[model samples]
Target: MSFTTRPEITGTFGVATSTHWIASAVGMRILEQGGNAFDAAAAMGFVLHVVEPHLNGPLGDMPLLMRKAGDAAPTVICGQGPAPAGATIAHYKAEGLTLVPGSGLLASVVPGAFGAWMLLLRDHGSLPLRAILEPAIHYARHGHPVLPRVAHTIAGLAEFFETEWPTSFATWLPGGKAPAPGSLFANPDLADTWERVLAEAEVAPDRAGQMEAARLAFYEGFIADAIDTYLRDACVMDAAGGRRKGVMTGQDLADWQATYEDPLSVDYHGWTVWKCGAWTQGPTLLQSLRTLSGIDLGAMDLNGAEFVHTVTEAMKLSFADREAYYGDPLHADLPVSTLLSAEYAEARRKLIGATASRAQRPGHIAGLERWAEAAVARAGRDLAAGPGVGAGEPTMAHLTERRGDTVHIDVIDRWGNSVSATPSGGWLQSSPVVPGLGMPLNSRAQMFWLEEGFPTSLAPGRRPRTTLSPSMAEGPDGRQLAFGTPGGDQQDQWQLILFLRLVHGRMNLQQGIDAPLFHTAHFQSSFYPRATKPGHLMAEPAFGEDVLRDLRDRGHEVEVAEPWTVGRLTAAQRDADGLLRAAATPRLMQAYAAGR
Candidate 1:
């Protein structure tokens, strides 16, 4: 079965992430309804919040970067949530909690994706907030089928269902079990919450008003109170959450506001890359691109050994800098200007070679700061066989977890304008809702450092650094593409590799997205406390045994993964002959490219 290379998906382009085909279909519908990319994206993002609660919710933070055709620079909408004023590292240690939480609880970060959606609508949108958000609201109320990814993630961690923690077995493991795909899953409470969004939109039908309604209903109103009460009961609400940690008093929610500011961006090889400022690690993307400057990566084929090897090494340099100097610039004094500086990139690029790197070096170029020397590494990494990270066994273990994929949409109007974004409440992996008020607080707050004085340490109104970076690139001759992925830390590696494949390797978008994929495993998990090693490669088996043997010869530790399986998700768009063409990664279920 071959997908024809056609450039007909125009007028609007949208992609829904994950195994939830219906939700992705909802996003495609917005474009079909004549909505622009932003509207489609906003709509798609809302659907994810409703159906993909395990990814994130009203509570998780969202750090976004975007650029349109006419804008001189991308606007930075810092949607990520801030730590409650009262949260502190001392509190976690005192409580005897591990503090380094994984996908579940303790993986909390500040959530702001929903607010970002409203912000985009206010800045540039033709559709009403109700229209844009209606799809998600309707779906949450009517119910949607369980996705394969959701079913598998849940089953893998059956212990979580058994835990007496705040997210008791009964809450997530309803019927004391994980829901399988094809099963009808419904959440009336979520339906009620989405309905409230419409109610608020009517109250202030304008953009700001719509946002106000959403912010008030989700953060300040009844939902806030319920979340506060839940946190208090769980004993995790330290001082950083707020002055009124108990039931999050009225004063706390009332103070919430959706904000926007000029995001920091740098020009690399004619493309403009933006990053969110001071509060989060938005600058890292720029730094990464900068580090790749003048590397002559075009000499290698996309996803080919040489190309993958060179880019991965370059990314490692950027990530090392990420660990050392990337953080809340407000407190840690990051070297953003210096890192993205032409001279600095020149220096960093020299450290990488066309040959594979044997091991990672410290981020001395970015300065000497580090996050506990030698404590960061990616998991299940093996350098052998190109890029793979599995033992090459087909786990007949059925996919059994249930969670919503991400929501992403990008648009280019006939007027030559554009909008690209991924709005998210997040997957449903967090603890169950606050009950009556509607929506779940982001359990992502726990992603921050539990140690005192760290740049990512918990603090009043401080945002956590994240890998959810929105990106864009332009050709020296004016050809361009704007794309991104929805897989947390994997977002960077996936987008980076895809871009290299499409532009540098000269492959079409589909070929770029479908080319064999691999991610370097040596780094600190931005979301967890796992150390991924340098030689580890999480890759598909289609490349064959010789490829794996070659990688092994080069000192790789290979882990063979099932083809078309992995957490990475990608999307793309390019304008040609007065129409915009797009493609979605078919590697995973439900990734579709639709427009017109």
Candidate 2:
């Protein structure tokens, strides 16, 4: 057997994995306390907001995939907030903006993560509201060791925050300086906020009512009041290099709530893989799988040039479709059925050849050619811009100045309940702190186009096609799997690669996660400036020079990443025999899996 960075955690009781050890521990603690996977996942989600503040926050968005013990398939919990009523292409253009500023009040969306978690707890969780939030409040008030990357991200934006976003400066830099790496850092304001929410929730006198009370406290109560007051007159510097006020209001918060939706699924080689819906970039993975189903992936070496090239090419095609057609289904006529159809996949698969193609190619469906054309036109436009002062999602260190990304949580309890959630957007750099709330607004609005007639066009009350995707699957042997990663555009890409290895290459959970990872940035990014790198493929150095050379020979613009730096993935699964398994990437030495 090949060596893995760590053993795949195995247990008969429960397992949890996350981007941070503290969050994973919190989840395990919940499980140990007799809470189910939903309860544990809710606790982990809140704790992650505290510990990985630079990566995610209360105001961020999340796409969760959850399966109850007896359920045949996982369901989706969409924590993604929509564009505010005042958010529109006309208003943005009037502000002299072509694209929504990647950072700043102008890019604010209705905060959804908090509401989503509350919804998850209310519907599926058995724990009390206070039990789920206590850990996060503790970390925020008492303090947790600040991650080095968090410090570096704060330092990079220190000057900008101090000068342009003094509110952010005051919050992130308490003593007028970025906290030193590993230093105990606390956000008393955030702690106080949660404490107040809890106090209000407790008035309901029961778990279910308390959960609803907490939701109201955040959406229609103090949380919304604070955000509304902050954005009212605060014209702050944004990623577009301009000062702008926001359009979000308390009413927007009052109008929005996290909802549940059916997951989109596709069967591949006896496994039924599930993803959050077309509203996110989740369908891209399904599309990739459909395309790959026609190919014999098992015939190629998992880490060799042939495997890398084939997967990369398939991803480019899938992501190309993402740019063209994937958007909030509530607002657009998405051709999801056709996009995931077997015939369409076969047709698209024919386009993949021995050489890399640099073109942006979204498949043409009858009558949907306009969307595809719009995608090509938007991608072709030369919008020469760089990531504004804290404007992009946390991705690879080399990919953005703000090296923070998103966070993923995977949990499975003894009862067979499971959750895979990817939460992101309200990074420390996304926007200024909302004064009293101790968290910034999400910049998800930047994912919407300012142009009209496209599914992703900026519109009030529409969910931005988010890159925050979580995944679940059921194997032929009846093992239920919950898996996901943190990279924005690369979330599904990295997940697709790992799933393939686990299914075809016969690697254990840890082996698949620890294996050298790779992804292509050959499609328009979902973040600010929306840059596209044609034929670009980034792989970890562990893939070896020979494989890299082979990729280059196939016309891939291969860039070798630092050893163990490609993906931040975590996974958990419940086998048919009642055993639980979990694993996390050792790429950044941050992610951890906890199980007996």
The prediction achieving the highest lDDT against the true structure is 2
Runs with alpha carbons beyond 4 Å of true place in candidate 1: 1-20, 32-34, 103-110, 154-178, 205-207, 235-253, 266-269, 275-285, 353-359, 365-407, 423-426, 574-577
The models' CA-based lDDT, in order, is 0.56, 0.90
- What's every prediction's RMSD, in angstroms? 5.8, 1.0
RMSD of 1: 5.8
Q: What TM-score number comes out for model 1? A: 0.84
Name the weakest run of 10 consecutive residues (lDDT summed) in model 1.
386-395
lDDT of 1 by residue, 87-114 (tens): 5666555545444343333334445676
The number of clashing residue pairs in model 1 is 79
Give me the displacement of residue 11 in model 1, in angstroms: 5.8
lDDT of 2 by residue, 1-596 (tens): 87888999999999999999999999999999889999999999999998898788999989888899999998899899999999989999999999887888988899888888888899889989888999999999999999988888888889888999898899899999999999999999999999999999999978989999999999999998998888888998888888889999999999998999999999999999999889999999999999999899999899999988999889999999999998999988889999999999999999999999899999988998988988988887776564457567745637554644799999999989899999887889888999888988888898999999888999999999999999999999998899999898999999999999999998999999999988888888887788888888888888888999999999999888888788899999889999899999998898999997
Off by over 4 Å in 2: 397-403
Clashes of each: 79, 2
Instruction: Give all TM-scores, in the order shown.
Output: 0.84, 0.99
